[model samples]
Target: MAKITKKEVEHVSRLARLELSDEEKETFTKQLNNILTYVEKLNELDTKDVEPTSHVLQIQNIFKEDEIRESLPRERALSNAPDRTDEFYRVPKIIE
Candidate 1:
């Protein structure tokens, strides 16, 4: 059980600089306690002897097989360039 107390709640509120009304503090205390109780229940679950799996569903690597091929010659590769100089694409200067 997520045991909580008024003093702890008050301390946290003070740290947060929250000017919580008594009613708000009480409500939050109950709500936070419930959340913590749920977490405690989850902690009680038996995870031993369970293999660590990456995902719940089965998935295989979906990719095309790699193949080797000769690359295009530099001259032909740059043939479609808007502007080329010295076998390389050229752009407007940007540095000051």
Candidate 2:
């Protein structure tokens, strides 16, 4: 028995707002059925003793410790700015 039907393909195409031709619908029905059939074969596997895992390989965090550090002075930080006030950078108004 076919896993997918032409009517089901047409219904999905309608839901997705796609306009498929008769030939395309026929092609997609066969293709989707083949994919489902292949996936169904996985049910025959013996996985009773297999352990479930999120990833195939082990993973570990490789990060340095965070520490407090001195920040850049305001005068030096604004030295390369195109526009600035006494204590802040001046940017063009964006909101009405």
Candidate 3:
């Protein structure tokens, strides 16, 4: 990877919403350059047939089906509320 200049570091910091001091920018510039160098080394590897992995472990779909179950009785659902209308919990109006 090419060495990063101070100008590039400041531009990247602006893009990332970071407010860095001159010292911090200098420090991050060196750190980011080193990280890029490592990534560049990884790009040199031959992995033509290797599959890209999202994680180190092989993961399967872990979600349950979305079918609805019977809901709680209205009285049970409102048991813990401080305020309710005849059929629903009520709250202070938040929208105009």
Candidate number achieving the greatest TM-score relative to the actual structure = 3
Q: How far is candidate 2 from the true structure (C-alpha RMSD, Å)?
A: 11.0
Instruction: Between candidates 1 and 3, name the one with more favorable lDDT.
Output: 3
TM-score of each: 0.42, 0.45, 0.49
Residue-level lDDT for 27 in candidate 2: 91
Model 1's TM-score against the true structure: 0.42
Model 3, range 1-96, lDDT digits (tens) per residue? 457888999998899998999999889889888887777887788999999888987788799789998889889989999999888889999899
| Candidate 2 TM-score over all chains jointly | 0.45
lDDT of 1 by residue, 19-80 (tens): 88999889989998888777788668799887888898898978876888788999989989
> Candidates' lDDT values, in order?
0.85, 0.92, 0.88
How far out, in Å, is residue 42 in model 1?
4.1
Ten residues in a row with the worst lDDT in model 3? 35-44
- lDDT of the structure predicted as candidate 3: 0.88
Clashing pairs in 1: none
Candidate 2, residue 12: how far the Cα is off, in Å: 1.0
Task: Give the lDDT of residue 58 in candidate 1.
Answer: 95
Clashing pairs in 2: none
Worst 10 residues of 2 by lDDT: 56-65
